[model samples]
Target chain A: AQSVTQLDSHVSVSEGTPVLLRCNYSSSYSPSLFWYVQHPNKGLQLLLKYTSAATLVKGINGFEAEFKKSETSFHLTKPSAHMSDAAEYFCVVIRSPGKLTFGTGTRLTIIP
Target chain B: EAGVAQSPRYKIIEKRQSVAFWCNPISGHATLYWYQQILGQGPKLLIQFQNNGVVDDSQLPKDRFSAERLKGVDSTLKIQPAKLEDSAVYLCASSSGLPGLATNEKLFFGSGTQLSVL
Candidate 1:
């Protein structure tokens, strides 16, 4: 069985500040991890993915996540936050082909 | 390229009523997926299709939910006698190929249909 846990339900940060959204996973195999963002009234958009190639994966909009096998974590981070980044973030774990197990999600609120 | 397309961006129906949502995958993509997203929750995979063949439907509730992809390009998901718990967003996504070998193929998503059960 595979599962993902997003540590925070909601995170608030002011624009230009550093942003972090924590996630941890449990997978039997070498897992594929992803970060997706969903804006208000919009569908999900892929941010980035880690497939065991590079431990440090860079994604769109200056967002990135590092795969730490020892910690079982793939936490999303950005050097500086922007108001447009405000959205619901989902941490996803895929243990097999075409089967994705998603975390509950963390709502990011950007304060101006 | 045109992205995944879905129909009926919003719908409201009474309990026990039936509703259907449509999806068109990206051009030449072989895999399609349907996911259910409740308020404040992540999207849950309900079904997966590889072209016209079913890849996985283990999480789909056959008693009230059914889906099909015709011609291996377009798909539809139907919910019969919907329950209050069925009120949520139905998202459709398509990928180019299997993972690992095609790990870079990110899922292209549709706008999704928001279903509201009264």
Candidate 2:
């Protein structure tokens, strides 16, 4: 079985500040991890994915995440927060083929 | 490329009523999935289809929920005798059902249908 846990339910940061959203996953085998973002009334958009290659993964929109095997963590990060970054973020774990499990999303709020 | 498309962006019905949602995946996507997302929770997979064939439906509430993807391009999910718990977002996603692909094959999701049970 595979599962994911997000460290925060909501994260607030001011514009231009660095952003961090924590996520941890557990899987029996080598798992595929992903980060997705969803804005209000919009569908989920893929941010990035980690599949057993390159500990450091870079994604779109100035975002990145590090896959740590020992810690079993895949925390998403961004150098600077933008107002447009305000949205709900989800951490996902792919246990098997076509079986993708998602963690409880973290709602990101950008403060002016 | 165009993204996944879903219809009836919002629907409202009373308990015990029936409702249906439609979805059209991107061109040539061989896999389609339906998920139920409750408030404050992650999306749960209800069913999956691979080119008009049922792939997995273990998590679907068979008693009241049913889905189908005919011709392998468009799909529909139907709920009968809806319960209060069924009031949530119904999300549809699609991806290329290829073999031995691990990471780059991303799943494209639609803007989900918001179902409200009164």
Candidate 3:
């Protein structure tokens, strides 16, 4: 069985400040990890993915996540926050090829 | 290059009533999926189809929920005798390439249908 847990349900940050959304996973095998973002009334958009290649992965909109196998963590981060960065973030773990187990999600708020 | 398309952006129904949602995948995409997202929760996979064939539906509520992709291009999901818990966003997603090969492939999603059961 594979599952994902997001540490925070909601996070608020001021503009130009660093942002971090923590996530952890449980999987029997080496899993593929992904980060997705969803805006209000919009569909989910892929931020980045980790497929056992590089531990540190960079994504769109200046976002990135580091895959830590020892700690069973894949935490999303950004050096600076923007108003448009406010959205719901999901951490996904895929043990099998197409089956994805998603976390509860973290709602990020940007304060200008 | 068009993303997944879904219909009935919003729907409202009484308990025990039936409702249906539609989806059209990207051109030549072989896989389609249906997910339910409750408030403050991530989307949960309800069903998956690979070119008109059922690939996985372990999580679907078989008694009250059903789905199909007849021509392998478009799909539909139906819920009967809707419950209060069924009030959520039904998202339709599609991916290209072979089934069970999604590590490299990406799933494109629609805006989703927000269903409200009264």
The model with the greatest lDDT is 2
For candidate 1, give the docking quality class from DockQ: medium
Q: How far is candidate 2 from the true structure (C-alpha RMSD, Å)?
A: 1.1
lDDT tens per residue, model 3, A1-112: 8899999999999999999999999988888899999999899999999988899999999999999999999999999999999999999987565667789999999999
| lDDT tens digits by residue: candidate 1, A1-112 | 9899999999999999999999999988778899999988777899999989999999999999999999999999999999999999999987577677889999999999
Across A1-112, the per-residue lDDT of candidate 2 in tens digits comes to 8899999999999999999999998877777899999999999999999988798999999999999989999999999999999999999998666678999999999999
* Structural similarity to truth (TM-score) of each candidate: 0.96, 0.97, 0.97
Better of 1 and 2 by TM-score: 2
Candidate whose DockQ is highest: 2
TM-scores (chain A) of the candidates: 0.97, 0.97, 0.97
Give the runs in model 3 whose Cα sits over 4 Å from its true position. B100-102
Off by over 4 Å in 2: none
Clash pairs, model 1 backbone: none
Report the C-alpha lDDT of model 3 over B69-116, residue by residue, as the tens digit: 999899999999899999999999888858546575677889999999
Ranked candidates (lDDT, high to low): 2, 1, 3
Question: What DockQ values do the models have?
Answer: 0.57, 0.65, 0.62
For B1-118, candidate 1 gives per-residue lDDT tens digits of 8888999999999999999999999999999999999998899999999989998999999999999998999999999989999999999999988634554457888989999999
Task: Output the worst ten-in-a-row residue range by lDDT, candidate 2 chain B.
Answer: B97-106
